[model samples]
Target: MAEALVDLLAKVRERSRGLLLRLEGRYTVVGDLHGDYATLQRVLNEWPPPYLFLGDYVDRGDKGLEVVEEVFRLLLEGKAAVLRGNHESPAMNVDGGFLDELCEKLGRGCGAVYKEFEKTFAALPLAAVVNGKVVALHGGIPLGENMRPAPLNRLATLEGDLTIPGDPLAFQILWNDPCNCDDYLPSPRGPGAWLFGREITKTFHALHNTRVVVRGHTYVSAGCATHHGGSVVTVFSSTAGPYRKTKPKIAVVSDGVEVFDLYTKSRAACPEDVDLLL
Candidate 1:
């Protein structure tokens, strides 16, 4: 298992992926799982990848480790890609209960497993661009100079493992949330994170040369929510732990975007139930 993890890490790093993972094809954009393995498995049984998982794989739920393993398995198989959510860092794992779960499950042997996961997490791309139109990320964009939204291409590349959320751009990309205002606002999540507005989303799309922003960070009761007049889509695909009340969903993106109601066994049975998206 250890050897396989090392090999997977090598394969992931060996790729020429920079800040964005560029792909041209249809994909199922999943939201934060937070270790909800059952929902993840069920969704996979139905939806056909390629899947773009918007991070937050570990922590919170009961099967974070299993979730990570399964996601990586799909990734290695070339069926999926993953983004780095706020919880992917060590600081988050400690607070979000993944560390406790790891210790309890693996006893003293969890350290090496965690080290590999940490390294794997660091190599994860912060965002993914689908068909050069829709942008999927764990969080939103970062604030540029003058505290404005930065150009997506002008961002600096990381030369080391991001064991922690120390880098400003990386931090925001993994922690920031969207809102309904006209500019950036302070986020209750923390000092590093911010709640951006509609224009900010528009500005980000303009600067990044993308039309839509699909991200996962906050909880939405419907399992999906749209901000910035549908420029931002937040999908929350979890029905475990503290998120039992939320309905889990995924964004199936091709020429356009459609929200698949995961609770339904057959997507065709309820075609009209799909949420509105541009």
Candidate 2:
């Protein structure tokens, strides 16, 4: 496992360095990783470049520290931009009693690792701009004046107090989802909307004057799901299985502000995976 992680990190560094230098345009957005290192590795290897990870780098799997470290390296190399998913927040994890468990899993004498984790988490961007379209955080539409994606852009600039709630942009960026969907409802059991229905998505797009919004927070059987007049798309990188599944989906972005998916293997349901990475 350690060797594999080392190799993955090395590959991420190399690929990210090259990709950052040459690629420009909208970013290929990936869903929550949840510490599934192998799945993340496979996607990175198959299609890398001009990508962004939509938070949840730790928890639900082993190697959370390694995941953050390698992701931090990617940020440094400029290969990708990261968003602060709900799971990345220490306060949220602490309230849920997962912080102590995670600390135990990480073992004692891991202060440096913990500090580094906090630092990297602090540095994640709260939202992204694909062309003129605004993709603001976790789930549900932003509430009040606090929910706008403009301030969330500061997430890319912050390196301290990543978990504090003083900055409206801080928490809202990872917690807000588009609220105009009908078919998909926000998960009653999770943070933010279980699913932002299609209705909410259409309204949001109309209000924002953008064609699409991208997000990740819930699990979708098909690896990717869309709603709101196809205005909002959710991409799930982790497959459903006791361990892992085979059909991993990735998004690729073009220079023209278009996003589509790059499937691991040919699947019958979708003739071809559309690029939805922007």
Candidate 3:
């Protein structure tokens, strides 16, 4: 198992970039799975490829290893694109459950495997641009009065190297959260991250010429939620559990974006406010 993990980690390193671009075509974007293997499998069965996963595949649930294995298998088979979430960092493993799960499943001497997985996490992309219109990532965009997003073209070549980014922009790309305010505000998540508002989202779209930003991190009651006037969408695929009350959802991107609940298997209309905004 450890040998296979090492090989998989190497494959992830060889294939992933910091940012992926020109992902043109119909695709399903999945949110944080948090080790809910059954729900992850259900989402995959319901949504056809090509698929993009917004990370947090492991941790917090009973089947972290199973979820990770399935996602990595798909990734290795060229069936999906996986981005890194904040939880992917080694620093987060203790609290996130991946580390403990590994110890339990692989025994105490699995340090090397754990380290290899960390490298794999570092190699995962930070974000992806689909059809040149929608941007998908794990967290939110960075915020600052004078801050402008890095060019999308350049971002495509960014690479991860097994360490959390120290660059403010890169850090925020993995940690920031969207807000309803008119400008950037301190994030309750921490000191470095900030909550950005709709105006910022608008500016980002204008700068990038993109229509929408899709991300995952926070759980929403409706399985998915549109913020920043529909310029930003958050999808959460983890099933209704002790951590959250909402059902899980995945975003389908074709002619337009549609969200489907994993449990109910029902398509949900975009909120009326989002309709007007978009």
Candidate 4:
């Protein structure tokens, strides 16, 4: 069993390396990783590019450094890109014990990794426009009427200055989640704000002429959710288990959308049972 797992990791590393040389399509979407290096390894190994990691690569699990290194390589080698998540720019420094624990796991010799993670976080975009058909972000759209593509373009190529507008689009990009309506709700995490509803997502799709707004932030144990006639599909890659007992899932996008549950080793089309959001 040990040998098989090692072989799997090696193959994944090779496949990730292959991404350096070539890629196709505008992008492939990844759900929240939550620092699961094993799942991240399997994803890179099993899937091809071009792919976009929807963020939350750190915290909530072990091997955060491994996750960071693989993704950093992918970004530097042009195999993939990333968007910011709440975890990447968490609400408070007081809540980062997990990051410190990750540091411990990676050990004291990993000062370079610590620096690398900081750099990677600095580079992550708040959003991306793919094939002009999809607008993706770590979270859904934010509140306010002035939201536009300019912010997304700016975010995609973010640089040195970390600016926060009173209505900073970056904050919304990482914190927004479409809920029942267009309203600002007090952030459960405190100091932060939460904007819930489909208005911004709809505006984004229409503004960009994209059909879907893809996101990750809220956890979906079943993998993903599609709303507003597929206008938005929120995906969660981290499986609903503490660790090894449950299998991770992938949000497979093609003609429409499907969930490939690693646990069941089965593929199912988008849920037909749920109501398409307003």
Give the per-residue lDDT digits (tens) of candidate 4, residues 1-278: 22332333343334332111212354556888766887887777777776688877777666654675577667656778656676774332115444575446656544444444444454455666665566667776655454333235444333344423123556667766666455344456435446454665566656656677777787654566766556777777874234334345666544334556644657745542242221
For model 2 the local lDDT of residue 241 reads: 34
lDDT of 1 by residue, 81-184 (tens): 87888888889888898988887877766778777778767878887778888888888878875788876654445655577857778888888887767788
TM-score of each: 0.90, 0.68, 0.90, 0.73
Candidate 1, residue 212: the lDDT equals 83
Please write out the lDDT profile of model 3 over residues 1-278, one tens digit for every residue. 77777787888788765455457788888988888888878877876888888988887887878888888888888788888888888778887788998988888668888888887887777788888788888888865436655555655455544366665666788888777677677788776787777778888889888898888887665667888777888888886344467677889875356788776768865442222111
By the TM-score metric, which is better: model 1 or model 3?
3
**Displacement of the residue 230 alpha carbon in candidate 4, Å:** 1.8
Q: Lowest-scoring 10 consecutive residues by lDDT in candidate 2?
A: 15-24
* Candidate 4 residue pairs in backbone clash: 179-197, 228-277
Worst 10 residues of 3 by lDDT: 269-278
When superposed on Cα atoms, how far off is each prediction in RMSD?
Answer: 4.0, 7.0, 3.4, 7.1
Question: How many residue pairs clash (N, CA or C atoms closer than 3 angstroms) in each of the candidate models, in the order given?
Answer: 0, 26, 0, 2
**Candidate ranking (TM-score, best to worst):** 3, 1, 4, 2
Collision pairs in model 1: none
Assess each prediction's global lDDT (C-alpha) against the native.
Answer: 0.78, 0.53, 0.76, 0.57
* Candidate 2 per-residue lDDT over residues 1-278, each given as its tens digit: 33443444444434432101222366666776766677667666876565678777776656555566667667656777766677776665555333554567556644444444454455445565555565534544443343223322244444435444445445544565534435344344444323334554555566656666666765554566655545666666765232265244555444222334445344324222232221
